[model samples]
Target: MKVEMILKELEALGSERTKKSYLQQGAHEPLFGVATGAMKPIAKKVKGNQAVAEELYATGNYDAMYLAGMIADVKAMTEADFDRWMEGAYFYMISDFIVAVSLAETEFAMEVSDRWILDGRELYGSAGYSCYCWLLGNRKDEEFDQDKLSEMLDLVKKTIHTSEDRVKYAMNLFVVTIGVSYLPLHEKAVEVAHAIGMIEISDGKGKHNLPVASVEIQKAVQKDRLGFKRRNVRC
Candidate 1:
């Protein structure tokens, strides 16, 4: 499972149509356009290779960077490593999913997420909210600082309408996560969702509409799935 071989595999798995779709979704050049389904076996083969993950991420290929996240050992990564990954995260998938998921597994999740959310950079800010969302979903209620989580809900209620586009989306997701996974905050989350209302994001030619938090929460409620905690944030 060398980086080079993995990259070749990604190249072989890539398709032009997928590349175009990725570009529409904010991916930059030097991407293989390999689908997630294709990356699974590669992740299986390279899992636990921290060195390989580092090298792959450093290469700056979208597929490789994503694969790096899949194979990375979050416990072995330092704050410095997380910072480096954040710097290289140019798109939502990389920033909000890959980097954020890894950060959620660390002790520094709250510290880093708080710092990044206030950052002026769009990607970093979005990553920050995403990290917080994943942290809320994965950790036990006892492990959470109830006061801080409540403060976060209040923050969303106050600023979600005025936050940067992607940050707003992530903030909305945070409300949904809180509503769905934290029983103590579910009602408050629904209230916050009603306050925020509709969120709209435009990517390329498409006007990407985010789910209404209240409605999503209601759907989860109907299914009797509220307050279900996730075991892990990463796929």
Candidate 2:
């Protein structure tokens, strides 16, 4: 389907209750508030439409931007395209999930993650951490870079507390991702999680209570789910 038709459908599907929930999750206005399940059929119809995805993303409507991620051809997207997506990311959902997941599917995953983590911008840094986490979760053990992952753990140990609130949250999730999916780094991730202790984040709506990495890792271990690779990270 065309971008115009998709936009019209999204507008028709918009929900005020869902929009309020999205607001709590950091979404801005000009949104359709379409649910993920509702967007899937549209995504299937528009699959592989890079041009149309770009047009949707450019609209800056929360729903369309999300749909852009769903329909984008990540392999065909240029580094410049990814950079624009990152810059246009307006909140955690768009940055950490949409942009980061798309970037992870590209060859630029490592390079982008490294650059974005050091950017110090909240959403960018969160996207960076999230990209790395998705990489670790999806890539096999043979393809893993142990040394670089170790260095990232050290970086988290040093800077997590002082990082932006959302970055800290992403960093905490990173540790959990390493512990649960990268067997070689599991112990080190637990150590870092213990060293870092509890993490706190807020979106200005309410008190944000994030998961403890060590505890989450332990639960995964108990369930014999360690080193389990996800088929894909993109939603």
Candidate 3:
């Protein structure tokens, strides 16, 4: 989908009541729309809807705090602009928007993720986590199998079921997603690349200054004999 088309839709949803409540008070932030009263994004994130929760958890409150980073042309992305994204989320069309964004300018993803990250913060999630996972997923580190992917997804689902902090799921999703892939995850090194989902890197935390992503990735890989976390992985 074209980013323009997806953007148009996100603008439409901003006028609703549910979205209106999302606006931060007394802050000169860009307006996305009138704000939806039907179902605030917060409602989705905190509902423990793992699908929604995990996705929402990755972005903390960047959406709400769009102004902090000199991001977003407050004028260009007016209330009308925000309404479109709100509308997209209402229909569970976030993935489509994500695809459009993925196809758009590379820098834009951080903006979208940042904006939503703020909302997730109020709702208890982290955008940095999602951004990190997305970063890893986009890398040509390895190929993934269906069963392994399924298992990784299942593991994330499992983590979601038990973890109080949704960010853990975000970290797990990144690891599990790759673990199930055909990467060369190494046991001897602190970091390894191409072990299904493993990527060789140092202790880097994109945000929140938390070292959870790496810790979880290593745990998942080392859980069973330096084996990738993928389930029944084929070759």
Highest TM-score: give the candidate number.
Answer: 2
Report the backbone clash tally of model 3. Answer: 58
Please, what are the lDDT tens digits per residue for candidate 3 over residues 1-235? Answer: 2323323444565553434444422212244543333224433323323233223223333232221111222233333344343433321113222322221224444455445534544112333335434543454444323454344344443443333334453544445445433245322122321122322222223323223434655565666433433221110
Locate the minimum summed-lDDT window of 10 residues in model 2. 200-209
Give every collision pair in model 1.
none
lDDT of 1 by residue, 1-235 (tens): 7778888999999999999988888889899799988899989987888999999999999999999998899899998899999999988989998999989999989899899988879889899999988888888888888888899999989988777788988999999999998888888999999998998877667777799999999999999998888887788
Per-residue lDDT of model 2, residues 1-235, tens digit only: 7788999999888898998899888888889789887898889998899999999999999999999999899988988888899989989999988999989898878898889888878999999999988898998876768998999999999998888898999999999999999999899999998999888777687567688888999999999999989898776
Give me the overall lDDT of model 2. 0.90
lDDT of each: 0.90, 0.90, 0.35
lDDT (Cα, 0-100) at 18 in candidate 1 = 95
Q: What CA RMSD would candidate 2 show?
A: 1.1
